[model samples]
Each structure stands twice: as C-alpha cells, then as structure tokens.
Target: MKRVLLHSAFWLVYLLQDTVLEFVWVGPALKNIPEDVQFWMAFKAAIAAVLPKLLFTYFILYVVIKEIIKGNVRLSWIILQVMAAFIIIIILHRIVFVYYINPVIYGGVLKERPLFHVLSVLLAVMDIGFVSGVAITMKLLRIQLVAREREKNLIKEKLGAELKFLRHQTNPHFLFNTLNNIYALARKQSEHTAEVVMRLSKLLRFILYESKSNLITIEDELRILDDYIALEKIRYDRLTIHFQREIDESSGKIAPLLLLPLVENAFKHGASESRFDSFIRIHVQLQQGRLTFNIENTKENHTAEEIRDNIGLGNVRRQLELMYKEYDLQLQNEPHLFSVRLYINLTSYAQV
Candidate 1:
C-alpha cells in the first residue's frame, strides 16, 4: 500500500508539471478562452499525454533496470531493446496526441502532421525522458540505501563472532586455574574444600548465565569478583590480599567477566610462584561514570619476557581493545612488584 501511494504521488507531480508547462507554452494563444476552460483543456491534455510516459518509465525501471542489475542480459541486447522501445513509445505518444487530444482540444482545426514527424518525436523524447530520469534516480537511491544497511549488518555480525571467540578463550583458561586450586585442597583433605567447591559453583553459574550478555551492572560484577577473591583466599592461606572498593555510584554497566582475567593473572604469576610471603592489593573506584581499577602484587625477580608471555594478561588486553574506545590499560613492572591500572570512561560505553 505504501509503494502504491509513492507511485501515485510521482505520477501526480508529473501530471501537474506537464499541465503548468502546457499553460506557459500556449497560454497567450488561449487568452480569448475562459480561464476555467483553459485550465480544463490543459489538465485534459496532461491526462492524455501521461499514459505513454507512464508505460515507458515503468518498463525501463522494472524490466530493463532489473535485468541490468542482475547482470543476466548482454549489453548489446539491452541497448537494442531500449532503442526499439524508445522509438515505439515516441510513435505511440504522437498517435495519442494527433488522433485524440488535438481533435478534442482544438475542434479538429489544427493541420494534421505525419505520424513520424521529427518535431513530434523530439517533443516526446523530452517529455518521456524527464519523468523516466526522475524515476530512475529514485530507484538507484533506494538500492544504495539497502546495500548500505546490508553492509552494516555484516560488520556487526563479524564483530559479535570475534568477541565470542575471545570470551571462549578466556573462560577455559580461568576454569583450569580454579579447578587446579580445588584439586590442591582436595588432595590435602582440608575442611575448607567443600566451601571452596560451593564458591566455585557460584562462579560457574555466573559465567554460564550472566556472562553471556554484552554488559552487566557494576554491582553484579563486584559480587562475582568478591566470590572469586574468596575462593583464591582459601587456596593461599599465607598470602595477604586486600580488595577495596569505593563506588560513589554503582549504577553503571561494564563488559561481563572483563576484570576476572586480570585478577587471575596476578595470582598465577605473582602469588603462586613466590617462595616467600607475597601480597596482592586491589583497589576499585567508580565516580561520575568513570572507573579506575588498580592491582599490584609482590613478585620475585623475573624477566620482562616471562611477564609479557602471560595468556591471561594478553586476553585482557585484547578484550579491552575490542570492547571500549575510551579506555587505558597500563602495565608497570618493577624488580619486586608488578602493577596494572585500567581506566575506563563508562559514559562512552553508554553511547555505544
């Protein structure tokens, strides 16, 4: 129904334009006639002239343009077809004007011209070409709009696939480390083993369900972080861990499971490998739609190559690049302490 209205509007405008042009060209000769009668004559002439123009325009748009876009017809054949159709339409238009319109409008007073007159054919070309050009331009614009929409959808799908692959890579690496901790507790026959298993179950449920979304509330993310920190504390009895959060506003969203890999990297490289007492310090602060996460852990002497080769840190870096445009991930490595600071503008995430 919308398409029908659009086509009707196009032809209506064409008819009005033709009526105005007819008045401008021959209005002085018809000055002796009543104004109402002159307008009626011009409108009648436009109606009579519209039939051939309409047919030729739609034929070129729907038939010739369709075949050209499909690339199914030869160029020479298409050119021959268009030339034949143009000649036939011009002849038909002349027949309509000479036989029907002139007799009614001029009372058969005008001299009869040959059907294939050069002047009549040239007038038909101008009239038909104007309407056809407008229709073809509209058709091409619609095609371009549809092509652009399809391209955007394709790019969105590709990005979604890549994010899923990166998330999958991180999930298994995280579960492996947690499961190893559980194994250690089970082998020692420690009483905290059951509690640790329960915490692991909660973490698994969150990973399986909540982490599927692109974003999650900061409060939910914090809860998961607390749970993971508790599980890690059970595994390392002598390690000093400080997890502090100062949130002025918790009403913000972040990528789910985005911070867990960083925490896991701290324990994997800093606390687990150290022979003496080690400490992990974590600070999370959110204010005015900006979040700052800083984690530092004491470590024994290690080469820069060893720290750079960590899978968890690499995963975190890649996810940050993929997810946020306004974010900074800084790594500070010293002889005895390694630190990571992440600053993100959540306002930008909201815009995205």
Candidate 2:
C-alpha cells in the first residue's frame, strides 16, 4: 500500500510542477488592455501557462504507469495523437482567452497572440523520442525475464532424466541379486524357495509402481527397504544383520530408490564374502532439518578392485551430483571395515 501511494504521489507532484512551468514561464505577450481588467488578465495568463504542462505530464504518466501495472498498454493511436492534440489545444485556448474573453471583461479589444511555431514542433519531437526509449526498455526487460525462466526449466529437466536413469540401473542390479539367491535355493530343493519368489515379486511390483515418481513419502521408501532386508534374510539365515532407525515422521518427501544402492553395496562387500562374526549395520536418523544415513559393514577383504566393481555405489554418487548437488557423502574402505556416511539437506531436496 505504501509503495502504491508513493507511485501516485510521485506523478501528482511531477505533473503539478510541469503544469506551473508551461502555464507561467512561457506566457502570452499581453497588449492593449485597460488597467481596470489587469486582475482578470493575470488569471487567464496562469491557466494558459499551466494547462499544457498538465496535459503532457498526464499523457506520459498514463502511458508508462498503466503499462507497468497491467503488463501491457494498447494505445499506439493515442500516443501518437497526444503530441499533436496537446499543442493545438494549448494554442487554441490561449487564442480564445486573449481575443474574445479578455475584451468582453476588460471593455477593450485585445489582439491575439501569435502561435508558438518553434516551441510546438520541438515539444512534439522530444515527447516522441522519450516515449520510444521507454517502450524499448520495457521490451528488453521482458525478453530477459523469459530467457531466465527457460534456463531454469532446462536444468530441472536434465535432473529428472538423470534420476530416472539411476532408478533403471538399480532395478536390474536388484533383480540379479534376488535371482541368484533363488537359484541357490532351487538347487538345494529348499521348502522356503516359493516364499523367496513371492518376496521378489512384491519387491518388483513396488519398484514398478512407487519408484517411478521423482519424490515419495518416507514411509513408502522405508517399507521397500524392509522388504529388501527380508528377502536378503531368507538367503542368509545364518548371517547376522543389525538395523537401527531413528527417522522423523515430519520429513515430507524424498527421491525414491535413492539409498537402496548403498545397502546393496554393503551386502555385496560384507555378507557375500565374510565368513564368521560377519555383520552389516545400517543406522538412519533425522536431526536439525537434515537426514543422516550411516552404513558400516565388516569387509573380510577390502580391495580396490571390489569397490570399483560396485556399479550401484558409483551411480549413486553421480545421481547425488545431478539431483542433490549440495549433499555430503563420505565413503571409507578400511582393512577390516567399509563404511558409508551420507547426509542430505532435506530443505534442498524438498525443492526438487
């Protein structure tokens, strides 16, 4: 409200000042009038001086301010007409006051003042140049705004594509691991073989339906993770896996299938190769508006070749760069343990 009032007041003061100048400064050359009617002539002179300036100021204010507020002004004809019309009006009003009205009131004939030949033409030319410059500036600002919007949309599209590709890669890697477990059970003719197949089907269904979105509720992601852990549990009944969670329900949404690759990497390096007292630990929590994921696994053999072969972990880093650019992820492969610590700025991820 204050800004709007300020805008209106600015125009009012501007128009009032210009009106005073046009009416008083370049006044008429009065002549041959009785002394008794001098007071009336002064009044006429004031109007003649102020009226033209008011009209010109009003024309400029109307055209530019209206365009700014409404986003466009459709007045090409009026803009052109104003320059000629205002000058003519000013001259005609001066002629009528000097020739007819003054004579009737002062009781003597007064001659008409000659029209301003050079001043009229100059005023018109300057007004045209000023209006043209304003129009060009408005057009340039609009073009620059559109270009910035287009650039932001392009970045959003690229991020979405990268996330989709990461999801696709994860799906196959998961399937290969599950099928291998099933193959082992089939060869032994175990009774839990049917149960493992059912679990795999449910996992596939969730990925196909829920994981397609850019973001999903935390509960949905947690459920998928639990189902994955169950499938792995069946494959290795003798191995120990300790899972601890301290997630906040208030966290709104996160990218689906984002953390599964890390879990798969842990199982690959920890459970598949370890022999005795081997364990994989996963701890998740939310604090101070940030989500933290810590995973540590006992690596029986910590080798560079094994870490390079971990395709899912590599893609996770790439996806984080493209999707959550400011995310902090740390990985350490010690002689006895391999650990991954991840922190996501929930505020930043929420924007995507």
Q: Pick the candidate with the highest lDDT.
A: 1
Candidate 1: worst 10 consecutive residues by lDDT? 302-311
Q: Per-residue lDDT tens digits of candidate 2, residues 210-321?
A: 8887778767777777888888877775577888888767345777888888888888768887776678888888766577889998877656344453678878887777
The lDDT for every candidate, in the order shown, is 0.86, 0.69
What are the per-residue Cα lDDT tens digits for candidate 1 across 129-161?
Answer: 988888989998998999899998887787777
Q: What 10-residue stretch in candidate 2 is worst by lDDT?
A: 22-31
Cα RMSDs, all models: 2.5, 8.6
Clashes in model 1: which pairs?
none
Q: Pick the candidate with the highest TM-score.
A: 1
Q: Evaluate residue 268 in candidate 2 and report its C-alpha lDDT on the 0 to 100 scale.
A: 72
**TM-score for each model:** 0.90, 0.64
